[model samples]
Target: MKISAELRAFSGRLGHDFARPELLQRALTHGSIASTTRPDNQRLEFLGDRVLGLTMAEALFSADRAASEGQLAPRYNALVKGETCAAVAREIGLGDVLKLGRSEMLSGGRRKEALLADALEAVIAAIYLDAGLEAARGVILKHWADRLKNVDSDSRDAKTVLQEWAQANGMTPPRYVQTARSGPDHAPEFEITVRLDDGREAIASGQGTKRSIEQAAAQALLDRIEGTT
Candidate 1:
């Protein structure tokens, strides 16, 4: 399989050359593509998810001397969250490098936040495999620096914040339910609703990314319940 010049140029810009360029190719491949033609990126996505977490944890530890796991976990979670990853993928033009099936391409898979985010993770995993942990760490730190920079005390996880808000006000913790799910098996969009004890509810739609959409739903609930826009 021929890797595009654009992808090569992009990887060069990322400052690391993949020894297994095929990993990069697999990273860019979505499940929507025909299996015989293009390999799916799911395995890489799984590996990348853990690689990103570990890399982010190391970065946070090195950057902040005083932060505990309590403080660091949320920041790490926020940094590697799907929305942030999708944003980074878009910033790096990963969608343009994606190999999609004709139908998925027409369905705008390139523009879907979930696909972009998953592909980004796959890329990170590929980087880790092709090069090493350090190479992947560099890529993550470079792309996620801004998000990581605000990783001090104020950086609370959405679920924690939501729960705290509910508890402080003498209310019960919020509950999450899958209100709806759409799309094919490989690429599904989820609609989650966050509900409080008194039946006050906030609904939000998101993609396959659990962490991101959960945070989004939590944010929506926080805003609505607190009446703070």
Candidate 2:
């Protein structure tokens, strides 16, 4: 089967020329616009998630022989998290070639964090299916080259650290309340206020999934509290 010129160029950007272009097509197709004839990338995403985990696990283990499982876990999470995947997706312009439905397009589905992340995983699965693990690993490492190189123990999620800080201080965990949601449905910007039981709070806003922006709020709050200490 034939793929579009746009996808063909995207193949170059992703550094994988498809032996089976249909897999690439399905990889970019979203559930919102899927049908009996054209399946979405959900299955591919599932497989790709595992593929990514295994690859990252191998890379991290091989890269550092002295690191413990506990040390490796956070770094692995840092690399495989949705935010990292979304960032890599943006770098390769995966969102630009997505096959979104009419409503999704209007709502800015292309830029949605979760959607972009899922599509990237599906594309990985496609590459794996087209060739093998080696191909998938090559693509992943190449796209995530800088991230993998720079990932360290300090790469732990900010949300986890913020909650830990609250517990350490004998205070209730920070509450993340969505104060305002604006923009279209698929790509809304959320304003989240992270408040401590003692009434200190920090507000932050960004476009993406609520959880991602909540991390931003948590980081902002952490910076504020820690800076004052």
Candidate 3:
């Protein structure tokens, strides 16, 4: 099968020359544009997620022999989270080669964090299938090297830390409310408020989906409370 020049370039960026190019093609296909002729990457994404988790776990365990599971769990989550995956996808310019449907393309699907993250996982699975687990591990470690090295800085999610703080202080879990939303249907800005039971609160605005925005808001609040901002 003849592959497009664009896909060839994408493979170059991905740092893996696929033996079965069709796997790469299927990995790049989105559900929005899937059909009998072209299947989507959902199954690949599922498999890739497990591959990513195992690779990250092994990396962390080997890198820090003295660290307890408590310390390592946060680092694992930080490395395998969708936000990190989306950031890696952007680093490799994965969005430029995505096969999105007309509606999705029109709605800026290429820039959507969730889509990019899922596609990146699918690509990982494709590499694993094409070669083996070692190939997938190589790609993941190459892309995530910096993050792995700096994993100790802020490994836990902000929300989890905040919840821990609240419980320690004999308070309820922090509550997050979507105070406002604006912009077009395709790209929206979210304003979220994170409130503590003690009347302390923080407000922040973020771009992308509501869930991510809420996390960002919680992080912002945590930063402020911890005097890290």
Give the candidate number with the greatest TM-score: 2
lDDT score of residue 154 within candidate 3:
53
Candidate 2 achieves a global lDDT of: 0.91
lDDT of 1 by residue, 1-229 (tens): 5667898887876666777789999898888784876679999999999999898888888888898888777777767777778888888888988999899898778988878989999999999998888889888888877777776533666788988978987888889888888987656788888888877788888565765677779987777766853
Candidate 2 structure, TM-score to reference: 0.86
Clashes of 3: 0
RMSD of 1: 4.4
Candidate 2's C-alpha runs over 4 A off are 166-175, 184-187, 195-201, 224-229
Instruction: Give the alpha carbon lDDT tens digit for every residue of 33-91 in model 3.
Output: 99999999999999999999999999999999999999999899889988899999999
lDDT for 81 (candidate 2) = 92
**RMSD after CA superposition, every candidate:** 4.4, 2.5, 2.7
lDDT of 2 by residue, 1-229 (tens): 8878898899999999999999999999999899999999999999999999999999999999999999999899999998889999999999999999998888778888889999999999999999999999999999878888889733867888988988998988889999999986656789999999888899999897788789889888888987999
Ranking by TM-score: 2, 3, 1
